[model samples]
Target: MAIISLEYYSEVLGMNREVKVIYPEQNKVENFTGKEIPVLYLLHGMSGNENSWINRSGIDRLIRKTNLAIVMPSTDLGFYINTTYGMNYFDAIALELPKVIHNFFPNLSTKREKNFIAGLSMGGYGAFRLALGTNTFSYAASLSGVLTFNGMEEHFDDNPAYWGGLFGTMENFKGSENEILPLAARFEGERPKLYAWCGKQDLLYSGNEYVANELKKMNYDLTYETADGIHEWYYWTRKIETVFEWLPINYIKEERAF
Candidate 1:
């Protein structure tokens, strides 16, 4: 596998951004014919950047034998939303990022069936938001995501500037496009298959359950799971492989030298 740190200017974000891409080595694939490869748009949590997943999840080692490309983008603390402070991170990820990726690597497939999204914590929310808000990804997964903000006031109440810049205020978040439940409800196109996993002891467990139940009521194809874990990288690193396994793609296995 080839791990590339690509830095480029994002016209959407109006600034230079860096993305980490994990691409399958073409020379390693048996009978290689330069076919289009499936892609997983992996996102990071609130306190992470593009390098979070690759550095912490052991994803590079786990998927070394699979013919899949992973794109990891940094969105700061925007929570993958079109922030009230005028940053269009949601558009950057949902729309511009793919075009950027495809422009750079033409072999990465653009079809919905070949595209997937997943993340941990804040990024888990981003995965659902991007998938439900747009028809780009065929599958979406979340690991201990903050699916709802119904009771998260205490977490941000003291930091008004931080919270205000992201959403204006907690009151403004409800029923807004930033909230996942409303996005799922208002979405009118094909629904992406959804997978959500949160630890039984996680602080966000109730929020995940609430959102999962609501999505079930809305007739969404969602898979929700819970086990002994927490909101840490150890839990995410183990579950990310499961997310890949849950995706509807056949892995092209290649023999490794090591």
Candidate 2:
């Protein structure tokens, strides 16, 4: 596998941002039938940047056998939302990043069926949000994601400025813009196949259950999993392998004229 660090100015964010991409290497004897490769928009947790998955979960090693390219973009503490106080992280993720990625890596497919997203903690919410809100990804997974903003606010409401800045007032967050359930419900027509996995011992376990059950109840194609674990890199690392198995990835094989 090959890893590339990308630094470019994003008009959406109005600043230069960094992105990490992992491209699977092909054999010298084997060649791709087409230029495009399947892509996964991998996201990071609140405290992590673009290197979170590569450094913590060793994601490159996990997907080394697959024909998938992983696009990891840093959103800082924006919660993957267009903040009331600052830049449009949501547009950066759901929109601009793809254009920049496609412009750079034309071999990466832009098709919805070939596209996917997954993230942990805050990124978990982002994966779902981007997938549902934009209809760009056919599949999405959340690992120990903050699915319920209200529940999180209830427990960690001490920092009003922190949450308020990203989501605006509490009433605003209740709308379809920030909440997962509302976003999923308001989305018309076909929805992305959703997968959610949370450790039973995780603090956000119930929130995952809440959103997962709501998706299931809405007749959504959702795969929900839970086990004896906690919210940590260890669990995310293990669960991510399962996510790879669940993804609808297509490998190209063709005879090349040498």
Candidate 3:
């Protein structure tokens, strides 16, 4: 596999942003096909930049066997939302970034089925919000994601005014544009197949459970799992592997041995 870190000017964000991309390389023993490749738009959380997954996890080595293309983008503390403060992060990820990616990597498929999104913490919320609001992705997964109650003061202790800047105010958070629960419910067309996993002891566990139960009630296609873990890389690393298993990856057996 080839890992590339690059930067480009984003029209939506009106700034240069960095992204890390992983593309599969050809196996010495087999011919490489020119067919479109499955793409995963992986997102990073709060303080994490584009390199979070590559630096903190074994993501580079995990999918070496498969012909999947991974795109990791940085949104800083924007929570992947177009903040009330005028940051156009939502448009950047949900709409423009895909076009940027497609232009940069023609081998990546633009089809709904071949495109997926996943993230951890803040990114987890972003993944679900983007998929549900735009109805663009075929599937989305969240690892210890913050799916509801964006106004929770405990999570944003460092910046008490955080949610206010993102959603206008704590009172407006529920059923607002930045909230995922209302977005998921309002989606009229086909919804993305969702997968969510969180450690039972994690602070956000109850919220994840609430989301799972609601999704089940809505008859949405959701896969929810729980285990003994906390909000850390140890838990996230294991969940990522689980995500790959759930995704429809066309693995190249011969290339895996390398």
Best by lDDT: 1
Model 3 CA deviation exceeding 4 Å by range: 28-32, 150-160, 251-258
Position 188, candidate 3: lDDT: 85
The most accurate candidate by TM-score is 1
Any residue pairs clashing in model 3, and if so which? none
lDDT by residue (tens digit), candidate 2, 1-258: 789999999998889999999987876213544467889999999889999999987777676667889999999999898888877999998999999999999999999889999999999999998988888999999999999865566533677788788887677778756788888889976789999999999999888888888899999999999998998998998788888889986433332221
- Angstrom error of the Cα, residue 109, model 3: value is 0.3
**What value of lDDT does candidate 3 attain over all alpha carbons?**
0.86
**Candidate 1 per-residue C-alpha lDDT over 1-258 given as tens digits, one digit per residue, 9 for 90 to 100:** 899999999888899999999998867655445567889999999889999987786788888767789999989999998998889999999999999999999999999999999999999999999998899999999999989988888756889898889888778887988889998999987889999999988999999999999999999999999998878898898788788788876554333333
Cα lDDT of candidate 1 equals 0.88
**Which residues of candidate 2, in runs, are more than 4 Å off?**
28-31, 250-258
Ranking by lDDT: 1, 2, 3
What is the lDDT of every predicted structure here? 0.88, 0.86, 0.86
**Model 3 alpha-carbon miss at residue 62, Å:** 0.8
Better of 1 and 3 by lDDT: 1
RMSD of each: 2.3, 4.7, 2.7
